[model samples]
Target chain A: MKLTDTFKTAIIGLKTNKTRSALTMLGIVIGIAAVITMNSIGAGAQNLILSRVASMGSNNIFIEPGPWSKRMEKGSMMQSMVEEANITSLKREDAIAIANHPLIEMAAPFTMGVGRIVYLDVDKKSSYSGITPDGQKINENNVILGRDINEDEVKSMAKVVVLGFTLKEDLFGEEDPIGKIIRIQKTNFRVIGVMEEQGVQMFQNMDTYAFIPITTTQKLLLGTDHVKWIIAKAWDEDRIDEIVSDLRLLLRERHSIYNPSGDLAKDDFKIMTQKETADILTSVTGVLTMFLSSVAGIALVVGGIGIMNIMLVSVNERTREIGLRKAVGARKKDILNQFLMEAVTLTFLGGVIGILLGLTFSYLGGVILGNMLDLKWSAPLSLDSILLSAGVAIVIGLVFGIYPARKAAELSPIEALRYE
Target chain B: MAKTTEVIEVRDVRKEYRNGAIKTDVLQGISLKVFEGDFLAIMGPSGSGKSTLMHIMGFLDRPTSGSCNFRGKHIDSLSDDELARIRNKKMGFVFQMFNLLARTSVLDNVRLPLFYSGLKGKEELELAKRAIELVGLTDRSHHLPNQLSGGEKQRVAIARAIVNNPEVIFADEPTGNLDSKSGQQIMDVLQKLNNQGHTIVLVTHEKYTAEMAKKMILIKDGKIVYNQKVDHRRFAKDGFEK
Candidate 1:
């Protein structure tokens, strides 16, 4: 028989028992839907993280005051606590040294603190960062109003601050707040500039910080001569590795941790390039997606078993039909093909419906998440995942259909015809 | 007029079925011959093994200890697929239950055997229509089996049997489930096909039904007790009596 004829016969058989066929397809439908939903959501999350990391500036690097292994090694809680007290070892001079390197374009040493800012009747609590003049350039901060802090401001330890977009909105709310004085802690500082709006990154709202000159912050606000971390940009992307090595050499020389064999555990500081951070984020999300999809795959297995169970029952119910076909000149292979085609058709229909349902759910989910996280969310429908899921469904049909098809083919026409 | 070509020839055929420790001999070395254009009826009581012998003659069951031939070719030596090909191309069957596929239209029911005939769609339909017309079911081709009366259902079965233009048709109690009127209509159709030169082997327990055939064989306890030509005068005369 022609393949089309076999498929047609299979279709007729399924159409005769429409309710039973649909019920048999339920497991596969849920399984495929779960798989597609997880795949799209996982891809969307990875894309969001990648774009956020990219927006933070791919050519930039971060240098923090701690050994690389301090956070990674187990049972180092006491060691990290002791190290945290002396973390003030990285001074502003080290940032200047790294900035002077030919491979480095700009460097800004900064520290973070949370404080309340009072402007008129509005007093809001927000995070504040101390950065130098070059911090605006390295962090991609654009001044929408007024001027950024200059070299003279840093030299004079000027009591001026730049408000983040969200902070400006909170205190002023559609009013011009540039040059307005805001009280930070016990000191009063004039807002010199308002930074352009930067959206959420890594789940943290980027438009919420107020920036002040590092010199003023260290001298008057923090009362510390040391900075917490240094952010730097490379002159060119290709020279990032060279600039990182130069910073590592300069920081090690200045900090005087001269264990020169480059054992990262013994080093007093950690330098991480933007690429390294992105790679770490990718790996973390990748593992998380894999684990989640595997849990969803369990549903697919259950669905396949359901298909097999229903196929066996169908074969039993249609024994006389099988016998009639055989008596009327149907070969064993024909019988097998008919039943197998029925199974494939069932799962294929289920897969198509599942994909549509999965896509719908994913789109709705993306919209809800986008609203909650305050980011633009797109439904991530990867063609590869769709194709893979379809392939899995077909293979499931074939594998599960085999035993029942064989049972049908192996039946004797006499016995089957005689079967009540 | 007797046709010289033998459609089926069975020799010393024996069929024994085993169920674990119990063994029952269904047919003990039975032999028979059915020629082309022959309308032969095999009659016996229940459990007489006539059905088993008919099954073996039709290549539906393999005899345990003898040879069966179709058109001078040994059937026991043929593979299962080969047997299926022979059944599809040269043999047709009608069952006592009027074994039309449930929920299937009369046209499609008649067209079932032609699916294996490798005939193109239009040609298969044309042939199916001719067979349905032959069985006087042209107006009822689109009706399902459940929607038709017992006689119409049996006619649909007859149409299905002849759609492939098989050289022989094996009918096992083709009218067994129908009333006398429906049974007489089924016998008339079979008689018309036999007259048109198609060999038919019918299995039945009714003596009147057996008398409609050109030859009759009576089997008792797995052995043929009577094999002879039917005397047309001994049976009741009907309007279309030969």
Candidate 2:
């Protein structure tokens, strides 16, 4: 029979029993929609993480103290002496040493502490970061008003601070706060700079911080000389790996640790590049996407089974019609083609509906998630996902449509015609 | 005297159907010949194996140990697809229940056989229209089977059967489900087709319906008991009630 005629016949059969066909297609619709939604959400999350990581500056590297077990293993008296000799740990001297490397562009040693700030009638708790003047350069902290902390200020341990945009807005409102004095834990400090509005990065509001000179924070505010972390920028992106190895070796030598290849957990420090962080995020998101898609794939399989079950029922119900068609001149292949075509058409229609619904739901879901988490939500409907869904729908139809079509085709004309 | 050309020939056909370990012999070595342009009826009581013999002769069932030929070609050994092709091109069938497809227009029902015949486009439609006209159902071409009367449904079935212009038409209990008036009308239509030189084979237990045929055969059990040319005087009045 002509393929067009077979398709027309199949369409007519489905049209005649609209409710049954729709019910059969429901499984497929939900299955495809779930697959699309899961994929879209997974891609959106990965993209959000990627953009956040990118905002951190690819050439930047961070160095921090290692696990506390390594530090506590020393005797209590020795630990106290080690703490007092902050230059022996991650300190300003190490930052100066790293900054001297030809491949290193700049390095800033920083320490963080929580402090209550009072400006006239307003008082609020905020994170106070102490950084050198080069911290602004390495961390890409752009100043929109006044000036940044300078070397002379750091050397004198001057009580001066830079307010983040949100901090300035909260304490001084619309008034210029660059020359104003704010009390940090009851210590008065002159505001040297107000940072530009940078918004959120890595899930933290960068606008809510107050920055001071590292020496001032370490010696006066924090009452310690040890720095918490060090930020460094690379002169060339390609030399980052070499610079990291060199820095690691230099730190190991400076700390008098032999066998640098030994267990890294025993090391007193940790160094990380932006690429490593990005790779970890990618793998994490990849696994999440796989896990979610598999869960949705189960729905597709159930839907396929539904199609098969309904098709078998249809074959049984139309036994007499099969007999009549055979009697009129329908070959076994004709019967098979008709039933198979009906299944494919049913699933194809369901797939189209599923794609549209999936896109809508994914967009809605993205909006909700974006609002809750305060991140940009772009609809992640990739062409590969759309095509893969369509392919899966067709395959499910063919695989599930086979058994019933075969049964219908293999029926004997005499027996089928005799069936009540 | 000129000899008639044989359209279907059945020789020593035996059919046995097995249910588990039990076997029932439906047709025991029955032999028959159907000629072109002849209206022949095979009459028997229920379970006499007349329907089995008719099924074998119509190529719907295969004989266990005998050979059947159609138009001088041995068809018992033909593949299912080959047999289907011959059925599509050379045979027509009308059933007791007037098995028209439900929810389908009468015209599409008639055009179904031609779908596999490879007839293209307008030509297939014209042939279907001619067949519908032959069955006198042209006005109800677009109506579904449920909208038609019993006689009209049978006529539509007949139209479907002849839409491919087959060489022979098989009617199995054609009026078994119809009233006397409708049955008479069905018999009249069969008779008129026969008069127009179409070969027809009918299977029924009604003596009045068999009386309208040019030749008749009576079967008892699995074997034929009487085979004779009908006497025209018995059905000359054209109505069974008279």
Candidate 3:
């Protein structure tokens, strides 16, 4: 028979049993929808995390004390906490020396202290950061209310603090936070400004913190010049590695340490560049997303099996029709094409419906995150995700539908004609 | 007969089936010839191989040990595709059950044969309409097969069979599934087409229906027993029972 005639027969057959065909298509539709939705959600999360990391200043480098510092020969527990007392490596003077390097644009020394912040009647546990005037530039924090601490204020030991957006909301509510007094660790400090709303950064809420001048924090609270870690930015985006290496060498030389190699087993301090941190986060998120989609793939397998089951039933029901067609001069190839086309058409329709539903769900996901967490959720619809889902659906349909279509096409006309 | 006028020739066709290990011979050394413009009926009891012979003649089944030649061409040696082409273009088939596409309208059912005939353009529609009109189903053209009565469905099947203007029309028990009135109406339609010089071959068990043919051949045990030509004018001059 003519190819057109065969296709016409298939279309008429499908039209005659619309409900059965639709139900068969439903299995593929749900499978495609699940695959597409999972991919989109996974893609959205990765993008959100990447951008948040980028906003924290892509070129910024982080240097924190590694656990190996406690294992040094002369290290007591307290001396290990203070890298300078270990006398084997890194000191606060090393951070200043690195900042003085030609490739380094700015450097900030940080010492974390736990304190309850009190404003009016409410008191909440918060971390206090002691930063140089340049720390604001290094961390990409720009004050939205008043102003960042000036160099003069840091040098003169002013007791002024800049509160993060969330800290301000808890301390002052709708009241103006600028020029307000917030007591930290039994010491009253005047609020100079409120940082803009920064969402989660590296798993820590950025909002529930306050920044104070490093000299003032050291003199008034800790009574020591020791700092927990140092953060620095390169003069240009490309020189960060060079700056980190120079800082490590300078600290090793000044502390009279023989070995300069940074073996975690022997090193007295740890210095992590921004590249390393971002790489860790990216790999973490990448593996996480892949794992999630793989879990969702089980649903797709079940759906593909559903399609195969229904198509087998269709072949059984249409045995007589197949026999009549063959007797009327339809070639076996023509019969095969007709059934294969029906299978593909079912999957293509399902893919379209799934894409629409997935996007709608992704949009709703973003809205819910934005309202509940006060975090701007940016889950964009990715085309690669949609195309990948469609390709998978087509493969599943063709692979699963082949057996049944072949069964229908290979039916002997005489035998099928005799089938009641 | 003229040398170039032979419409079909079956030369010692043999058919056999192996049921498990035992071979059953269905058609044993059968030979026949049908000329153009002849109306022949094959009469036989069940298992007499009339249906098997009809399948071979219609190119739907292959003979085991002989040749089926149509219009001087060896159809038995043709490929499946070639056989299908010949069946689509040169042969028409009317099955006992009416075999109309159940959900299709009478017009589309008539158009079914034309789809396989490799015919297109406005001429295809015109020819289909003319065939439907010949079957006296022009007014019911848009009605589906299920909507039509038994006789009307049989007429639609006939129109579909003849729509391509085939060289020979094969009806295997064409009225076997119909009522007496519908059966007579169908036989009358076949007789009118035969009068128009179209060749027809039918298989039937009913003697009354077999008498409508100008020539009747009876088969028993895979062999022709009685072959005779009846003058229908003799019946028309008297009554059908005479």
* Candidate 1 lDDT over residue span A1-420, tens digit each: 878889988888999999989988888999999988887788788888888878768788888777877353332335654675558777888888888888788888987777888999999898888888788777677888888888888889999999989999999999988889999887899999988898775356768988888898888888899888888888798888887877777878888888778788787788887788677668767877898798889999999999999999999999998988988999999999999999999998898888888888788888888898888776568888888888898999999999999999999889999999
Q: Rate the local accuracy (lDDT) of all candidates.
A: 0.85, 0.86, 0.77
Q: Which candidate is the best by TM-score?
A: 1
| Candidate 3 total steric clashes | 0
Candidates in descending lDDT order = 2, 1, 3
On residues B1-242, what C-alpha lDDT tens digit does candidate 1 reach at each position? 54478878989888888999999987787788888888899999988888888888888888899999999878768998888888898898999877788888899999998887788999999999999999899999999989999989989988998999999999999878987777778888888888899999999998878888889999888888899888872222263232
- Taking all chains together, the TM-score of candidate 3 against the true structure is 0.88
Q: Which stretches of candidate 3 lie over 4 Å from their true place?
A: A1-8, A67-92, A111-115, A151-158, A200-205, A215-229, A251-265, A370-373, B1-4, B231-242
Report clash pairs, candidate 2: none
Q: Is candidate 2 or candidate 3 better by lDDT?
A: 2
Error of 3 at A199 (Å): 4.0
Model 1 spans with C-alpha error above 4 angstroms? A70-89, A201-203, A219-225, A378-380, B1-3, B233-242
Consecutive 10-residue window with the lowest summed lDDT within model 1 chain A: A70-79
Which fraction of the native contacts appears in each prediction?
A: 0.69, 0.73, 0.29
Task: Give me the displacement of residue B167 in model 3, in angstroms.
Answer: 1.1
* Candidate 3 residue lDDT tens string, A1-420: 566666677678777789977877677777677666666666766677677767667677766554454343332334544644323243467678778878887778876677888887898989888887787777777889999998898889999999989888888989998888889988999999989987776545767878889888888976777777788787787877777777777666765556745655555566666556556556766777778777668777777787788778988987876766666666666667778777766676777777777678778877886677666677777788888878887888788788889998788655665578
Query: Which CAPRI quality tier does the interface of model 3 achieve?
Result: acceptable
